[model samples]
Target chain A: MPFTAPPLFPGDLFEGAARLAASAEGRLSAVSEAPARAAVLDALWEEAAALGWPAVMVPEAQEGAGGTLEDLVAILDGAGRAALPLPLAAACGVVPAMLPAEAGGVVLPFVASGEWRVAPAFAELMRDPRSPAAAAATEGGVLRLSGSVIGMEAPPGATHTLLHAPVDGASGLILLPLDEGGPGLRRFERLDGRPSLDVLLDGVTLPGTALLARGEAVARAAASARALGTLLVMVEAVAAMGALVGQTIEYLSTRVQFGETLSRFQVLRHGTVDLYTRHEAARALVVSLVTAAAETSVAELDARTLHLAKLHVGRAAREVAEGAIQLHGGMGLTDELPASRLTKRLLCVEFDYGDGAVHAALAA
Target chain B: MDAAGTDYAAFRAEVREFCLTRCPADIRALVARGGKLGRDAWSRWQRILFDHGWGAPNWPREYGGTGWDLRQRHIFDETLAESDCPPQYHHGLRHLGPVLIEYGTEEQKRRFLPGILDGSVWWCQGYSEPGAGSDLASLKTRAVREGDKYVVDGQKTWTSHAQEADMMYTLVRTSQEAKKQQGITLLLIPLDSPGISIRPIRTIDNWQHVNEVFLDGVRVPAENRVGEEGQGWSYGKFLLHHERLAGANVAPLLRQLARTRRLIEEGATEGEEGRRRALEHRLLLAEAEITGVRALGHAALEATLRREPLGNTAAVIKLTSANLMQRLDEIALDATGHRLVSRFRPVDGNAPPEGMEWLQNYLYGRVRTIYGGSDEVQKNLLARTLFGH
Candidate 1:
C-alpha cells in the first residue's frame, strides 16, 4: 500500500506554497551559498509578498488578505520544505499577529505590504523577565532602551524589529528601525544558514509612538506573538524534517555497502523507518496545534498546546536529525549532501524559541 | 451519522452515559484489576452490546453493526475505555469479520458473521507459526488437498487466547509457488478438530494470554478456505491493517499514565521535595509522549476512515504506541518501587497489593513491540515502501 496522509492543514493552500517552494529550490540554494545574500533575500521576500503571504493573517479591513491561521502555517510549511533561509515566520506570523489591531495605522501598512522586514525579539521578554535585553526606561513620553537581544532572526536584512521591553513597571511593545548600519549591530549566520543578529543598544532613543502597547495590552500581544512564532517555526522544522527523510531515503536507495544497497540492509531500513516516525509525530503535533489555532484568534492561542508542540517537535527534530545523519554514514558527516545542511537546520530548530527543557518546564 | 450534521458533544455524552450505565460492574472490576476477560465475561459483554444494537461499531449495519462513523466509533471506544469496559472482541469482529465481509462467500458469511456478532463463537488468529512470524509470507504451515478436505500440519505459536477460542482463522501453504505469498490460503478451522492440541505458554507477564497450537494432520473442509486459493496473502494483509489500527486506541495509554500519576502522588513524602520534582518531570515527559501519540493516532484514524492507503501510518503508529506503552509501564513500575517484585512472584488472591497490578502490566507491555509486528519488522516494511528493494 502507498504511504499517504491527509495533506497538511488547509491542503490546497499548503500545496500551492509547496509548489512555489519547489520551484524556488535553485534560487534557495544560491541564496544559501551567497556571501552577499541581502539581494536574494529581498527578491524572495518580494515574491512572497506579491503572493500575499505576509498579509495572510492581517485583517482585510487593514488592506490585508485576512487569511486563516492554517494559511500562515501553509506558507511556513512550504518554507521549511525547501529550507528557505528567510524570516518568513517573523514577517508572516509573529510580526503581523503581534502588532495590535488598534495600532494598525502606525505599522499595519508596512507589515501588510512586506515593505519592512521585521523580526520579532520578544522571546527574552516573555521568558526571562530580568534579562537585560528586555530592559527599558520611559520618561516624559520618551523611551530609552539599553541592552542587546542576541541571535534574533533575519537581522542581517531586517528593516525593523518588533520587541517587548519593561516600561513603567509593565511590558511595552516597541518597533525599532534597523536600516542604518551601526557598530552595535553584528550580523552572523546561524548553523542552518539563516541570518542572525547580535543587537546591542547603548541607550538608543525612540519617540513615545514607538511603544506599540503598554501594560496588559503589550503582555497579551507578546504572549500571542510568542505562541504564533513558536508554532510557525515548529511547522518549519517538521516540514524540513520531512525533507530530510526524503533525502535520506533517496541516499539509502542507491548507496551501496557490502555489495548491496543500504536500503537492502535491515538495520539501515529500520533506521529510515524511525526517522519517518519522528517526522510523522512532529507533523501530527503541528497539525493539531494549527487546527486549534485556526479555531481561535491569535490572542486566544492556547499556551498549553503551544508548549506541548514545542517540547515534542523539538525532541522529534533532534532525533530525526541524528537518525538521518547516522543512516547517511560517511556522507552524513560532510557538507557534500543536503543531509548535513538539513541536519543543522533541524538542530537549529531544536534550540529556537525555547529548547525541549524550557518547554517541558513550561508544559509541566 | 455525518460529521458535519452530528453534534459530537451530544454523541459523546450519549455513549459515555450508555457505557457508564450499561457496562457490568463485575466486568469493569475484572478489567480494573488488569485481569484478562475470559470467555464468559467476553460473551456477556458482547451479548449486551449486541442486544443494544451495537455489536460491531466498525462493521456495516447489514453485518449486524451500528454503522457508526469514524468519529462516533472513536468516541465509543474512548467512552468504553473510560468506563472500564472489557475490551470488545477483536479477533473475530475486527480482523476476520471485515475479511469475510469483503472476501467471504455468502454461505461463509452466513455461517460466521452471526457467531462473531453475538459472541457465541470465539476466533483466534493463526498467522504467526513456530518458523514464520515477522516474515509471515514465509510461513511453512502446509495443507495438502485430499478430496473435499485439506489436511493441515503445523505448529502456530503466539496464538493469543487459543485455548479460549472455538475456532482458528489460519494461513496455510496450499501449493508450492515461486512467490511464498502466492501459494498460501486462509482457512477457518474448528479448534475441536481431531489432531489439534493447544498448550498454554506462560509469558514474563505471568499470564496465559497466548498459546501454542499444534495441528497434526487436522482436516478442514475445502469450503473453509476464504477467497481464492492463492489470494490469502492479500486477505492476510487486509486483516493485518485492522490489527494495526487497534494500536490507534490511545485511551488505555492515557489511562495508564493517569494511574502512574496517582501512584506518584501516593508515594510522595513531605521531605522528598527533590525526588518529587524529578518524578513530576518524568511524568510530564510521559504525558507529552501520550499527547503526541494521541494526536498522530487520530490523524491516522481519519486517514483510514477516508479509505486512503496509509503509507507508513499504521507502522508508525504501532511502533510509536508500542514505545510509549513500554515507557509508561516503566514509569509506573518506578513509581511503585518494591511492587516490581510482584511480576516475578505469585499473588495470593484477586486483591494482592496496591502496585502489584502495575508490575504485571509493565511486564505484559514488553510484548507490545514484539507481537503483531516487531519494531524491526515494521521499520523494514516501511522502508520497502519508501525505497523499493
Candidate 2:
C-alpha cells in the first residue's frame, strides 16, 4: 500500500512479493547475525534475480517487466515490512528507474540474466558542483575516461560502478568494470556499515556500448537516478523503522515492571504514541514523493515535501530506536535483543544518503 | 491538478457543488474561520445536510441515509471539509445512529433515527464517568428497574455538547450480579427529565461545550433501553468502533491543511526565513498525517473486503489522527503568531482577529487525542489486541 490514492501498479508484479518477503524472513532469522553478511545479501539477491524482480522497473519493450517505479515500491515495501533489508530497490530501480528507453536494451542482459552487479555512484564533485571530474574524451572514435569518481558508495560484492560522467559537456553514464588491484580506487567502510569506494579513473578506455545515455537526456537520467537511489534507501528506512516501532510496542506490553506491564506507564506509552505518529506521517509523505517522482522529473517533485519526509523519518528512526532501548532497560543495551542491532542500523541509516541536517538545510 | 477521475471525479464535483451552495454562508464562514461553532450552527449545518439526504452516510438506506460505500463516504467527507462547510456533528450521526439501526427495536429506530438525521434532536454520549475514562467498564452509573421505568442515578462526565443535547444515550448499571461489563446496559434518557442536571465545564479556551451530567433518580421508560438489558457494554464498544472508524477519515484535517497552506501563501515574507521553519514543521506533520490515513485506510479497507475483523486497527488511526490534529493546531498557532502572547495571554491586534481564532482552534484541537479515546486508552487497546492482553 504505497500511499498513492490509486492502485500501486499491475497486481501481477507484486503477487510474488509476499512470497519473496517470506523467504527473506526465513533466511534472515535462520542466519542469526549471519557470520556471512555479504554472502547472505548476495543469496537474497540471487533469489530475487531468479524471479526477474530486478527488471520490474525496466520498460517492457526492452524485454523486461517494463513496469513503473510503483511496482518496485511495492516489492521494497514488502521486503521492508518483513524486515528483509536487501537492496531490492537498487537492483530494480537504481540504474534503470531513470534510464532512457533506448538504454533499456543495454541494461537488459545485465538485469535479466544477472550478468553484472551495477551500483550507482552519485557523489558531490570536489571542484565543480555542476559536473563531476570523471570527464570522458573521444578522439577519432577512440574513447578515453579520466578524472576521479568520488563517493561511489557501492555496497560490498558489487562488480561494477554505474558511473555518470561528463562527456562532450553532457551527463551520461558508463558502466565501469571493477578490476583487480582496483586501480585508483579506495574502498572503505560506509557510514551505514556498507563498503564505499572512491576511484580516480585516469585515462581508461571504454567501448561506445558503455554509454547509457547522452546529450541533455543525461542530465535528466542522472538527476532521476540519484533521486531514485535516495528515494529507495529513504523509503526502505521508513519500513524498517515501522517494523521496529511495532516490535518495541509489543516488547513494552509484555515486559512487566513495578508489578505491571511497561505499557501501563503513561510516560512510556505516550512516548510510543509520539514515535508511532511521526513514523506513520513520514511514511505517508515518502509515498507521495514516490508517486510524484514517478509522474514528474525528480527535480519537479515538491522539494520541501521531500525534505520534510526525509528529515522526519530520519529523526523518527532515532527517536523510536532510542526510546525502544530506554524502555527495554538492560536488555536494550545488550546485543541479546534485536533492538540493539536494529537501533544501530536505524542510527546509521540517518547518514545513509544524507542526514536530517542535510535535508533540513535543503528544505529551508 | 486532477485528483480523482472518472466517476470519483464527477461525484466529487457533484458533492462540492452541493455542499458549497446548500451549506449556509454564515455557518461555512464560521467553520472556515475556526471556532466552537455553538449549538445553533452545528444543528443548522446538520439540518442542511439532512435536507439533502447526505447526513449520516454510515446509516442504512432504509433509515434515511445515503448508503454510500466507505470510500464514497470518505470522498463526501473530503469534499465537505475542502469546501469549509461545518462538519456534521458526529455525536448522534456517527456514534449512536449505527448502533440504533443495528440494535434498536423498530420503535427505537422510528423514534431515534429521524432526529439524528434531521437535527431535530441533539445527542450527547454518557459513558465516561469521573473515575472510569480509560477503564470505562468500571462505570458506576446505576439504573434500578421498576415496573415500566428505571430509576437512574449517578454522574456522567466529559459529555461533549451535553448542555445543548436534547437527549443522552447513557450507560447504566442494570444488574450488579454480573461482571463489570455484563452488568451495564444502555438507556436513552431525555436531558430535560426531572432529577437530571447538566453543569457546563468550560474548557481551557473558556468555551462551554462539554458538561458534567448528574442524574438523581431520573426515571426512564423501559422502552428507552437499546438492545437487551446488561448489553450496554457491547453497545458501548460498538459505538466506539463507529467513532474510531470515523476518526480515521482524514477529510476535516485536509481542510485545515489547505487552510494552513493558504495562510502561509497569503503571508509571504521577503525571505520566508522564520516563516519557512514554522511552516515546514506543519507541512511535515500534515503530510505524514495524510499519508498515514491513506496507508491505514487501505489496510482497513482490505480487511473489510476480506471480511476480517478490524480488531483494534481503528485505535491506531484514532491515535495518529489525534496527534496530527494537535500538531496542525500547534502549527496554526505558530503561523498566526498566536504563540507570541505576552505573559501567556493571547493578545489580538488585527481585524478579524485571526490570532485569537488560531488560539481557539488550538485549544479545541487539544481534545482530539483525549476524547475519541485518550492516548493512553488507545495504547492499552492496541496492547491488548496485538499482545493478547
Q: TM-score of B chain for each model?
A: 0.92, 0.89
Model 1, B324-383: lDDT tens digits are: 887877666545532223112221122333446675676566566666666666776788
TM-score of each: 0.52, 0.51
Off by over 4 Å in 1: A1-364, B1-4, B242-244, B269-275, B302-309, B347-351, B386-389
Show how many residue pairs clash in every candidate, following the order shown: 2, 4
Consecutive 10-residue window with the lowest summed lDDT within model 1 chain B: B342-351
Clashes by residue pair, model 2: A58-A66, A59-A66, A60-A66, A281-B288
iRMS, all models: 21.4, 20.0
List model 2 lDDT by residue over A63-162, tens digit each.
6777666778777665664545555665567777556666667766576567767666553321112233677766667557877764454534667777
lDDT per residue as tens, model 1, A74-158: 7777667767766778777787777666776677777788777777876362221123555667878888777777556662367
